[model samples]
Target: MFRHIWIRLKFQNPDKRRPFYEEETRRSIIRKEEEQQWRKKKARRQSETVYDDHEADAGQNDGFTPTEGGPDPLICDVAYYARRVGLDMEEFKVQTEDGFLIDLWHIYDPAEYTPLPPGDRTPLGPSTIPTSPSSPPGPDPETKKKPKYPVLMIHGLLQSAGAYCTNDDASLAFYLCKSGYDVWLGNNRAGFNPQHTLLSYSDPRMWAWNIRQMGVLDLPALAARVLTATGAPKLGLVAHSQGTTQTLVALAKEQRPDLGERISVFCALAPAAYAGPLIGKMYFKFMRLISPAAFRVFFGIHAFIPLMMTMHSLLPGGLYGALGYRVFSFLFGWTDDRWDRGLRDRMFQFSPVYVSAESMRWWLGRECFAKQKCILQTKEEWREEDNQDKVEEEKRSSPDASPAEPESGAGEIDKSESHNHKASTAWYDHRVPPFALWVAGADLLVDGKRLLRRFASGREPHVRVVHQKVIDEYEHLDVIWAVDVVEQVGREVKEVLWATCEGREGWRIPVGCEEVGVWDGKSEGVVGGGKEKEGEGNGSGESEVEEVGRARVRPRSRFGGWFRG
Candidate 1:
């Protein structure tokens, strides 16, 4: 067991988290001997790297387009969550006559609101488009002041922001809406919008959602309908995986402390809130027992929607991509606490049923984070060191780390080696808990130092980028699509949207498609639309893989008759 937990974190007890868990166990044993010498040279160039069979035939019809308006969860079913899950995910069992297996609940169906489609235009609105603003002109010459708040990216849990923005190759919300930033690719409330005004579908409380009601109710009702159509006040919260668990439970439960200062800049791309018992307490004790509200009161009683669409059409797409990386590694591997090596080579650029194992059991917690739709728990002040300062004020006014972290007197952590070394460090020193170490080494989920210490600690006005790095292997949904991470993944999330839209001499950052014939002048890299051309490269940069091990979960599905009787 990791050499008996590295011999008890190398004979524990001399403090400072034993040289930070002995330098994270020697960088997890030099990242597992450099992923076992890059899986023996990618298994000896796995017979001359076949570009994953022509990038699995480019999303087979750009995969499901159908939307014409907005919010359509399930009008009379059929499309049955995009035809029985894009086709090939067996294990069906909707049995509600008291048998059990309704469990299926992944949503997102608003593809119909189309308005601006001319040879093209500019400044933000919807379909997001921009790519050149990394270093532009400035103060007024051309108006660099457009970035107020028009970003909405969100993704997480059995994810689906269209597998990291794939297009022209690797997307991340179409390179941050073509780099201007009024981007809006949010698909929450059920990974692919299952339409809900007041949570309907015969409201069993809208399938009693999870992931903290997708950031407290589908991300503040899609940011209060994108701030009443972009009048803007707050709407710049880019996330990933459980969309940073409802953006850290909607900014540590906000109801308004100026609504997290209107979130002008919060780009946490791999921020995983860690409680960890395999993604925290055995995934909320196996979805509080077999996935919520008593498995929808026995859902389908061995139903048979055309034999579950002919066992998802007789399988065989790499055995349904190895039974979907064994249910994406038995559910977001360790529920994505972090470390995400292009999640099984970016699930062949998605569309293989974009999220919905009941929205990955709603971040495992299930329900009631104040009945979601955001404005999550404000009234701030943390620490509660056995409680002494006696500050229970909270009528809803937090952020700015609530009066320099009140709630506690001795400032929490009263022992047990400072509470299991602040419970397994890694929020870059100040050992995790909020703003997640201002997002390091890329990928996509977040913590960004726990939302930058709940909106810039010390009375606010915070600005930290400190010692950043990204050797590669980006994870947490590959920071929005991972062709490269929109020009080297998060350069301060485009320098904090260019210091919140008004810094560096006019703002620039546009070359589009990697400039000069593309390959990335900086069309924001995270790559996918079938990469592997440039010098026909194949993992030579110290190639790595040996994902420790474990794939299991195949006893069925991939054509095996599930949803059984």
Candidate 2:
């Protein structure tokens, strides 16, 4: 780690770093000015209006305004960050099957939805597996207004749900809420506070879990709570990095396949299905070479690198942010080139959360994922599949090859071949939901393109790829943090959720998506409601949307130009 930091310090240009600092300074000034204006407006409004104390308080929280003291650098709370952007977050504790109480946050607009009181935000226990579709309940039954379609957003590794709330209006959770969705942020077990009903923190059994437990236990618990709270039978599932990994594993037939029935659509950002080239780095190689006992010795059985969390608690926010960025950049090769430099510090505050040493061991230990370079299949299994495919390709390409005369046992041979094909290729079952992928083309952390090929080549026969895109310039984190993410990823995700949504009869249609047709797998325009207008630039380095389809539900204005040069 020291050597990597030294290399960066020696080679990276100081001149290039100056622009990011300058931009952050400018943004800070703008935020202060905006906050001042908001205070003046609030005071004026209070003077003009006459109402009861309760009414006045409600009115005060209704309008859009910056936070009271501008952005707080030290605040790590999701609710606080949500309030900074005129939105509110309500926390609900969800108990997993194993009795771990994880946090689930709901992001709602103050004007549209009333906040649930602290006592009312009750802890939800494990749910029975849902089997049928049902209509969602309204926020207030007296008003007769339909509830927004519920959507659950899961965070990446070492990060909490707060990652989705840091970018203010540009944040994915806030953007989706404004665009008309009931957004819920789901955190895995033992995020910041490790609480359980039975086991104590020091108990080794409490820490004896890996990604499989997360997939089979934590994910389902969160999904169940979101569905029960919204009264919706199914909700759109969005995941990034390790979030996608858990979802992928859970949806597999051998795992908790029943969980997929509760999800309308799965939108994966930077899906980490296959190992990337970075797995071969020297440090990672060393981890792969070490024994499990040695791995436990290096990273204690309780938590992986607990010292990072200690620094997080002890150091000042600004100092921690700077050091955190440098350390993570050295380890993962992440840069703020595509992120908004003004919010870089805020983003780091949510990460480096508590993750188990066993989870890290499963990811990098000698006998697990790192050695096989895959989560599900062994290296030898992959090689055999590749050789079989090569032989099939050779047969297709050879022009001189002739068909042989049928022998007496030809029928038996064909049946055997068909059974082998199905057994070797299929990973998911019929219960799997439709998938929409936004792959980071430049990401070295995971090979999302290879996963895309797996679906496109009919390997996962049950998987339906409703929408797919490769953002050529995006890095692993850019799908959620990029400056233009609202246009490039957010808008598309909004439309996809609406298009593939099931049982939309009583649901509230989101803004800018009224014309989005339900995707029926027959036409290409249903997802975006228009054909791409070739050679027509929209002056934003993007192509404009043109309506062409006759689908029942069509988009009035399409969020096009996702593909960049």
Candidate 3:
């Protein structure tokens, strides 16, 4: 398939063999013509529609209305936005065990200035102290020490650290920093800044990796670096979408339990894994269902969706927002397009950054859907390996087993025991660190609730479910870019961090977390409590399970069972 596309792109199109300037000029002309046609069509639609004063007034107040004099979307990224909002921003580079160099941006609250490094001070506010649930140890009440634990925020696919800072101080990274937490925004390989120590951008080898590399190398390296940089024993992890996927693969399936130990909590916003079949939208389904090779042919090898950047450079500023909204909605599936339209230009500026063709295959390939696993290993392979270990265990435990069997079993068991010890410390098994999962109720791109349920229910006993929620109206992207996200999503995040800081135990929902009026779906009265009303949810874009308790559902099967029966 790629051979065919390459032949057509290179051979059939004579411009491919020509100089770069000529080819680029031709492409720009075509793009400009397309944009002009779109603009004319848009003007025609507006002129055709009969509008009155009341409708006009409503349109002005609607969330999609563009605000004047907004910052240039392209230039105002995470770092730029953080600096603009009176927060202190510092940039650092993290090189993975592999040669990929990841960008890490740290946000600090200007109000809490201290010389004790980044993460050595005590927490601010009377409530933010570091007290163990088992031992009531914390700073004295008179000092009001700043929170020492750092938070590493990882953005989703096709996004940079800019996703968290796009909403200004209302962004999650900024919100955490202001509320007395050291915040670090992490950029994975192939993001806007795809720098590496040894590889050039032109080398396909540089883009030869995917989420697998992120799980095994990038995430751990970044987290360890954050720990070392902050001088803290543990840092909380806040990840969204694909960010959560790699973190889960790293900490759970890959069995790097030490990473879990270093991370105080994992806050997955719109978690992506075990993705349900794309529902309601054929465009989204078609996009996800495309074979990885074909997708590579369409997107090319260097950048996964280079078209966005192309459109940005080719289309005029006034036209890209409309195009960006439509294209993104088609791909990602938005129930309520929550990103402020005012910043639509900026959203396009940094989006659809380069991703390796290999990584694209990982997400959309047969290994993911056929085996019901998203990582490098298939589900059957993982299950078989696990069963082998279990079978060996049964032999060792049986009294009638041979001496030699036990002797060999003893060595294997020791090794297995070490792995099991690491596995025991996983978040799903609830052995050590706590986590909070925020699900976007209407997300059609990935099954956020299923990701939450995998750990929340029908699993081994471990630590508590720190916080579990489904904002009924939000789509895949709204958790990060929504207009009201600061109030609805940001508050819950701060509360969960606060709980971890105060040394609370299992399944503690944040206090005073009433259902926001913005979440007009079924979660009307559920709040910070363990009790949830059980009922089969109707197809009202809401989940059936309660807010807390019950790991009752099994891991989802390959095709069906997106929701528990």
Q: Of the candidates shown, which would achieve the greatest TM-score relative to the real structure?
A: 2
Better of 1 and 2 by lDDT: 2
Question: What is the Cα-based lDDT of residue 339 in candidate 3?
Answer: 57
Ranking by lDDT: 2, 3, 1
Ranking by TM-score: 2, 3, 1
Global local distance difference test of model 2: 0.76
On residues 1-565, what C-alpha lDDT tens digit does candidate 3 reach at each position? Answer: 4765887876575334432335345434543453454455455557896544343323223122211212243563555566545576766666777777777777764544433454432212111112223432334245555234578898887777777876654567766676556788888886765787788978877888777678767787777667665555566789998898788766653345556766667788988865655633564345457776776777677866666666666776557656766777666655334555445565655566767767766665543542344332345643543454456556666899876545646877665664454344333443346667778887777777655554544343454556677888777887887766766677667655644543332212222322212222222232232221353122234443474344222221232111110
Per-residue C-alpha lDDT of model 1 across residues 196-299, encoded as one tens digit per residue? 33444444444543454455444554554455444554445667545665665544422212334445455666556432233333544555456355544433
The C-alpha lDDT values of all candidates are 0.36, 0.76, 0.58
Q: What tens-digit string does per-residue lDDT give for candidate 2 at 1-565? A: 4765775889964434442466456656766676665565567576886545443233334255434443466567888888777788899988888889899999988876887778766665664555555555644676677789999999998999888987777899998988889999999988888888899989988899889888989999898888777778899999999999899888877788988888889999999888888888899999999999999988889978877888888888878878888888887888788687767888889879989999998888887878777676766655555565556656666898787877999968876665456534466788999898888878888988777765654456578887777777778898898777876788789888989887676788888777788889533334554232454211133221121111111111111111000
Using all chains and alpha carbons, the TM-scores for the candidates as numbered come to 0.25, 0.83, 0.63
In terms of lDDT, the poorest run of 10 residues in model 2 is: 556-565
**TM-score between candidate 2 and the true structure:** 0.83
TM-score preference between candidates 2 and 3, better one: 2
